[model samples]
Target: MMVSYVLVMVIIIKGYGKRIGEYIDEECRREIEKKWERWEEKKRREEEEGVREEMELWREESRRRIGEMKERMEEGIRRRIREKIREKKEEIEKIEGRLELEEEEIGEIELEEEGIEEKLRI
Candidate 1:
């Protein structure tokens, strides 16, 4: 309201009031245009910053997932190695059991032969 009163006073100054008022109007329009341009530039920069931050977050997430996958793969490999080792151990135990049985049978046959030999001598 104060600005409007001041403009009214300037417009009723003299016969040159119209020209002066037009000049002031032109200056005000230029200032308003400059302000709008600055505001738009600020908004554009903020949007660009937001997009950059989002992209960085996405990249970090991707790296994290990749790390997790790599760890899982390594663990799987280790588990497979352990399983193979267990199978080899079982196979060795079975071979040892068979050998023991064979040795006992051989000893029994030797004792029977000795007894038969003593009976022939008598």
Candidate 2:
């Protein structure tokens, strides 16, 4: 009778131990899954930050290029204006003495020179 009782106890212990082991394995799996989720979140945030920084750098470079282009355009305009002024001065000088000019025409030429000088100031 005692041997029978011992055998029943052994069977009960095996059944409950297997259930406990399964419970422990489930908890471990849950913890591992949670950690994986956190790691993925961190990785995603870092990638977004990297992309934002790259865009900022690109914007700065674009602004610099635009500024340089504007400077070049302004310089070209100024150069063209100067060349026109010089050519007009040469033409006026040729007309002043080489022709029989009226006083009014000479005055008009002087006024034209003054206007050209004003444009140069700008």
Q: Taking the tens digit of each residue's C-alpha lDDT, what string does model 2 give over 1-122?
A: 99999999999879897998899999999999999999999999999999999999999999999999999999999999999999999998988856656677778898999999999998
lDDT of 1 by residue, 45-112 (tens): 99999999999999999999999999999999999999999999999999999988988888888888
Give the least accurate 10-residue stretch of model 2, judged by summed lDDT.
Answer: 97-106
Clashing pairs in 2: none
Q: In model 1, which runs have C-alpha deviations exceeding 4 angstroms?
A: 1-23, 103-122
TM-score of each: 0.61, 0.65
User: For candidate 1, what is the lDDT?
Assistant: 0.93
Each candidate's clash count? 0, 0
Per-model lDDT: 0.93, 0.93
Give per-residue lDDT, candidate 2, residue 37.
97
TM-score of 2: 0.65
Candidate 1 collision pairs: none
